[model samples]
Each structure stands twice: as structure tokens, then as C-alpha cells.
Target: MTKTRRIPFVVANWKINKLQSEIAEFLDNVNSKVPSQTVVETGIAAQDLFLADMVRATQDSPIHIVAENVHWEDAGAYTGETSPRALKDIGATYVLIGHFERRKFFNENDSTVNLKVMAALRNGLRPIIDVDEDMSKYAQFMDAEPSVAQVASALAGVSVDQIRNITIAYEPTWAIGSGEAATSEQAQKAAHLIRQTLAKLYSPVIAEQVRILYGGSVTPDNASALLQQPDIDGVLVGTAALDPVKFLELINIAKQPSMPGQFDTDEV
Candidate 1:
């Protein structure tokens, strides 16, 4: 592509799906079939209950494990919440926060997401913060504009080098689970806005270093074109990730060399 320093990442968010038994089988499939030294980095974000088992299964492989969500505190009486320390202890390299389901069903807000991100960083875990472009669904219960702006602001001020350890997922709520994918142009436009927002809040250097991903109904068939977009560093795949062959195919596509006119013509 543009010869960027950051590697391409493919994250599978198996939200509330996959049993422990299934996870073990999936790990085996991944270990045996994964590419040796491709440009793409593979990762899976499983349910909180399966984090330990998943990590143990993928310990020997280069595949990274991620927790679907975690609490802001290290340890306490948070009944249904996962501790960041526990996640790190289990060898989780990444944590996904502010997912669409969490924001829609669990009443999670920007402040809570910010705290969780800070806690994940403090525990030496990378945070993959998810931002949904379609906030119309939450407009009545929450303000779309300021809510998004608050999250952007939170990430901007959290750490000394926040963007370095953070990966952003721009999931347009309208496209999620609808079997419809955003056009390459649409995805690049939104992703560029996210980068611009970061640049405005932080410095241009940090914004350039930060990786922005496109999520929602990403499949093997569409991944190549999507990753070819200049602003799209990677993908946060959902249903397509459930199948081993499909998931690997997506990663393989991302690892392919960029073709002419695939990325931005303006970029060197």
C-alpha cells in the first residue's frame, strides 16, 4: 500500500458466541493454518467467559487474543465486569471497548469507555475502542454529536502517547448485522474523519501513527477492496470470522500487495 510502518490487523469479534469447546477447536484450526510471516496481524476477541481458555489455546501461536470487554478498575466488587489486570494476566494483548452491543444494550457511555481504556492501558493492554457512525438509534436516549465528540476527546487526553497503543474501529451502526457493507469510498471518508478528529485533538504525528479499522459485516469477498483504502488500516470482522477458512481468507487478502489506484493517489 503506502508502505506504512504499522502492520495490518484483522480482529475477529465473536461477541457472546462460541462455546469453550468450540474455542479450543478454533484455536487448533488457527495454529495449523495461519500464515507464517504475512503483513497482516491476526487476533480474536472472544467472550469474557472464554478469555482464559482462548489465551491458553493460542499461547504457542502468533495469533493474539483479545477480551471482548473489561472494567475500568483493576479489582473490586464489580459483579459482572472483567478486570483489566485479569485480562493482562491471561496474556490478552488487546481489549475491545465501546462495542455497539455494549453501548446499545448495556447503557455504557463515553465516560465509562474512557475509564475502561485508561485501565486497560495502565495494565499494559492495548485498547481497541469502537466508535459507531450511526448514532441515530441513540439520539433519543443520548446525544449523537457530543457523545461521539466526548469519546474522541477522552482518547485525546488519556495517556502521554494514547494513539500508539490504541486502535479505533469505526462501525456504522446502520450497516451492522444488516448484511450490507459500506462502499470503499464511504468507509474511507468516515475513517479519514476519525483521523482528522484525532489530529485536531492530538498532534498530526500521533494521528498518523494511530490505526483506524472498519467494522460491520466485513467478509472475505470484500476485505481486499476495503483494506486497499488509504485510511482503512484493518478490519473488525464479526460473523465472517466465525468460520476458520473465511477468517483466514480475509487476512490473506489484507496481506496482499497493494495494486495501482487501490489506496489514495495523493499518498506517496
Candidate 2:
């Protein structure tokens, strides 16, 4: 049986942005602003320094709190790193791994990402693994290693059931922070490719069970077009996510009914 979550996920990747004071004000109005007409599994990814505040702010609300990233190890001599235990303690239900920026700036390759994914699962945290092709071509990374490899590597030893806890966010390096989002067709193509790769690595059922979200320059203007794509389960929002009004609009856009052929087809 296909175990794909198939739920519409609207996630906010606050990244390294957002101040404690700004977060406090936003969370105050977010719960009341969420539209009741449509349902979208929404979450906010706060910077490490602000996760606790974000978590506390969202308590008793329908929104879920997410952490930008976390170390793979639960505990040890790894200095200056927050343990998965720490995230759970702070009430972070999800974590991000393998974002293009992390790989570029921190030299985090697929191996470390695999470790992080397993670690997040081990600690009861659902992970949003980012797998995006480096479009800059300045590094020639796409030729060196496709994003698909990163996805496969992250799930190397994860069991079928464990895979369901993972949300694959396909954010290409080019589209992010550029203020220029990919056309809906382009985003869907990448989402489909990722799902197809999952089928090859595991089973069609597990592949379908995995949720895929598109990221990079996701604004309210384009969220509906992207969410309408058959395989696109949701979004890993960036710039617009920092604003409460825009973020709620984006979530409402995702709430709109998806077209037919979104899932029942054979081709990814």
C-alpha cells in the first residue's frame, strides 16, 4: 500500500533571519489569522537562537514549530552544536538538513546529511531534507553529482516507515533568494524527478508516501501556481514567510483544491 502522506504542507524556512522580538509579535497574530476554510500542515523554521521563543509562541495553536537545522549526534564531544535531544526539549517537531547554503558554506556533503537524517529520525524529529541542483555551474556541481544522489544518500538506511517522517524539499540553488521563482512547470518537473528517484531507491508505495515541497523565491503571487502541480505537496517558503500576512496568504493559496491527476497517475 502506498504510504505517501499526500497532505498539503506549507512550511516557512526562516533561515538565519528573524529577531526574537519580531518572532514574538508575529506568532501572536498567526494562530488567529490562519484560514479555517482550508487545511494545510503549516510549520515555521526559526533560527537556532529563536526556536524556543518560536515554540513557546506557537503553543496551543495549530501551527508547528521547525528548526533550521540540527546536528546528527544526540550527544558527545561535538562542541558548539545543539543536540537532537535539545531540539526535542525545546519543542521543535521538524528540522532541515542539506540546504544548498549549508553544503556550500559548511562543506556538508551527502554523507553527513545521511547521518543527520537518521539522527533526526532517531530522536523523533521529522526532517526536511533539501536536495537541489547547483545551477550556478560556476562549481560544475550538477555534472559532478545530481541532486537525486543527495536524496538517495540521505535515506541510505532509513526504513520504509521512517521515510514517511521525511519531507523532501527540492530547492534549486538558483531560485533561492533571487526574487525570481521558477515557472510552475519547472518546479513540478523537479518534484516529479525527485519522486521518481524515490521509487527507484525504495518502492512505488514509499515513493508516493514521501511528501515533496518546492522552495526558493516562493511568494504569495506564485504559491498557487506551484501548489497546483500534481506532485508538489507544499512549499518551503523563504522571503515571504517572514511576514505574517504574506505567509498566511501563501498558506491559503495552498489550501485551494489541487487539480486532478495530482496523484493517481503512473508517471511521476
Which candidate gets the maximum TM-score versus the true structure? 2
lDDT by residue (tens digit), candidate 1, 132-229: 85533334532122234644744845754655789899898888888888987788777777776676666655667777899988998888778888
TM-score of each: 0.88, 0.89
| After superposition, candidate 2 runs with Cα above 4 Å error | 1-5, 35-38, 134-147, 259-268
Score each candidate by Cα lDDT. Answer: 0.79, 0.81
Alpha carbon lDDT of residue 151, candidate 2?
A: 80
Question: Which ten contiguous residues of candidate 1 have the minimum total lDDT?
Answer: 259-268
Query: In model 2, what are the clashing residue pairs, if there are any?
Result: 3-209, 4-209
Which lDDT value does model 1 have at 242?
A: 94
CA lDDT, candidate 2, residue 173? 88
